[model samples]
Structure formats: C-alpha cells, structure tokens
Target: MDTEKVTDRKVELEKEDGHALHKRLSQVDPEMAAKLHPHDKRKVARSLQVFEETGISHSEFLHRQHSEEGGGPLGGPLKFPNLCILWLHADQTGPGPSVPPVYGLEVSDVSKWEESVLEPALEIVQSFIQGHKPVAAPVKMPCNEMENKRSYHMCDLCDRIIIGDREWAAHIKSKSHLHQLKKRRRLDSDAVTAIENQSISPDCDKELKEKGSPEQNEKELKSSV
Candidate 1:
C-alpha cells in the first residue's frame, strides 16, 4: 500500500468522531474491526478519540493504557503484554525459540518492536511523543455491578447495566446497541444476532409493535381532532 496514503488515512481517522471512525474502519478494514469484541469497542473508540485529540501515536496510546498513570478503569498494564506477544508472533515465522512467554515480555523489547513492526505501523497511526501532550487521562467504562440486586445485563458496548431480562431483551434492539454493534462491524446476519434477538420477550416485542403501529397513530389523531 502507499505508505503516505495509509498515513493520511490514519490521520483522518484520528480526527473523525468515534462513531464515524468506526464506520470508516468497518468499511476499509472490516476484518480488524470485526475482531474487536463488543466489550472492547467503546474502550477502543475512547482510545482512538484520545489519540485523535491528543495526536498520540497508537503505541503511546497502548503505553498509557498499559501504565498505571492511565488510571483505574483501564484495568492494568498486564493486559497489553499479551497483545505485544501476539504482535511478535505475527511478525515472526512463529515465536522463535528465543521469544519469551507472555508474562516475561518486557518494555525494553518495545524498542526492538518500534524499529520493526511498530515503525511501519506508525505510518498508519502517527505518534505525538514530542508535542501536544495529553491534558487528561482517557475516560473508560464504569463496570459497576453491585451484589444482590435485580438481575442485570451489562451492555457489552457501553457497559451500562440494564436490569430485568425483558428490559435487557428490549435493549438489544435499541439504538444504543445497534450503534455499538455497527461500531464493531458486528451487525451481521449471524448466530450471535439471532441469539440476542431470540432472547427478547414476546411481550416487549408486542409493546414495540404497538408503539409503532399506524392504528395507534390514527387513534391519537382522531382523539386530538
């Protein structure tokens, strides 16, 4: 691919709104977008948003996510070493005998990666190590689920805890869920979608149908007249 063209695309993506960015990514790199889990979509979007606003390179973004300085909602640094190892494995024929286990991965090796895989990748994700330092940490999802409460289903996209099976069922067809699903390039005629739809309560579907019915609209119109 044209390196400059790729770089420009990355730059454009960085500047785009999160939802729009996701849509563009889905169109251009659907495989990569599809690999993103639902729970991670917002986090990735948040990271992309942070990168766009701060002009940080993706590596720097990952570094911040891996470090304690990025704050609590980001989980921990260990979450990234595995990703690094995955990168390494993808680069080599295999791990090569010298490649260490995931837990043994080190930041010192990041320099090596930077020279090889990272530098090339940077063309697609320009970094801002020297300028426009971030003013604040990126926001993360609040996964607050208290013990012993009404049953809830945490949205894999936004992480909002929705209570009740019926409510959760209705939520799957909601705009928020659809937005997130599209963001992850997951809005497909797949078994997963089937399962989510199948989980909806019959009553909720009826209510939704009634709410959208022309008869209800006509009734309201007649009453108002």
Candidate 2:
C-alpha cells in the first residue's frame, strides 16, 4: 500500500476500535460514555486508550470505574440550587449610585458552581434516571475485605490502628477524635481547679528545721561553745 493509503487505513482502524470501545462503555457506564465529545474521534478514543494501557481485563476496568479509588461515577442524587441562574442579576441595570457596582463576572462564583454545585446536580439527575432516591450513605467496603496490602498507623484516641495512610489521616481529624480531645481538656482543667482549691496555705513556713532531743541539743551547744 502507498504511504498515504496506509495512513488512511490506520486512521480507519483506529476509528473502528474507538467505536467498539464506546459500545462497551455505553453498556457499562452510559453516562460516562456520553460525556466524551462525540464529534471528536480522538478525544473519544483517549478514554479507552488509557484503560488499555493499564493492561487489565475489561471487567476489572469496569469494576475500578465504580470503585472509590476511581472516584466513582460523577453523578449521585444530591440536588443543588442552580448557581448560574440563581446569581443572575434580577435587574440588568448598571449598579445603583448608592451601591457601588462590582464590575466583571465573579470567577469565584463560577468556580464554586463548577466544583460543588454541578456534582450534586449530576448525582440527583443520575438517581432520578436510575429510578431510585439518593442514598444517605453508600455501602462501604471494609478495610479487612480490601485487596490492597495497606500500612496501618495507630490512633491513640481511638486506640485502633487504622489501615492505610488515608484512613489514619481521616481518623485523626474525625469528629470522634476531636470530641475525645475536648473531653480530655475539660478533665485536665477540672483536675487543675481541684488542685488549686486544695493547695497548701500561702503563709506556711518553708524554712527547714532540725529535730533533736533536749540532751542532744544541749550537748551540741556545749560542744560548739
């Protein structure tokens, strides 16, 4: 085949490969597959390409997709107020004379909406589509049941060795540990107060004195003389 023909053939094969990957992805995670730019063949191919590079089976890849380690699906059932519409100016007039106008779009507002608002909305939409209400708490895989060999660190307050660096860090910053620390401080403060209340009199003599019988004292004085 001519170089040009060979190049065209390669491109055709790549497109076929991407479409096949998309078909599988649609069955496993339709929503995730939908997020790709359908018009951009290269972008569509990239997702499956990365998975292939991992050298794992397709089933294992799908398992990881929904795992916490994978960051799970981008959707859930948590609803959030529409920020862009909510923050839209009710009146599009220039800032009032009494109220100085803040010029330009609030980049922070846009960022907050993107980072926080969108996820919950997606989750809520997902739940509705899935024909279920959002779960209050996701069922977690126990540390003991996990396949990875993780290092553990001791949490003094919890008195347990939490498996994995992330778990240990979370435990130390957890409300349970914080509450225990607060209780410990209160107990220590009360003990100090009790000691203060029961302290020895301030006027009590601190000077040292020798104890001796009368004869011993007299003999010492005569010897000194």
- Candidate 1 per-residue C-alpha lDDT over 4-113 given as tens digits, one digit per residue, 9 for 90 to 100: 53344345444546556656445544443443433344544654555556766444554556566533433443433212221322222232222322212223465677
TM-score of 2: 0.25
- lDDT of each model, Cα atoms only? 0.49, 0.50
At residue 1, give the lDDT of candidate 2. 55
lDDT of prediction 1: 0.49
Residues 1-225, model 2: lDDT tens digits:
566533443344356765575675556545445544333456445545544456554445555655644233332222433211112223343321212112222234665875454665556456656766643223221233332224435667666545555556677888999998898899999999978765653432232125466888899999999
Show model 1 residue runs off by greater than 4 Å.
1-9, 37-225
Worst 10 residues of 2 by lDDT: 96-105
Model 1 vs. true fold: TM = 0.20
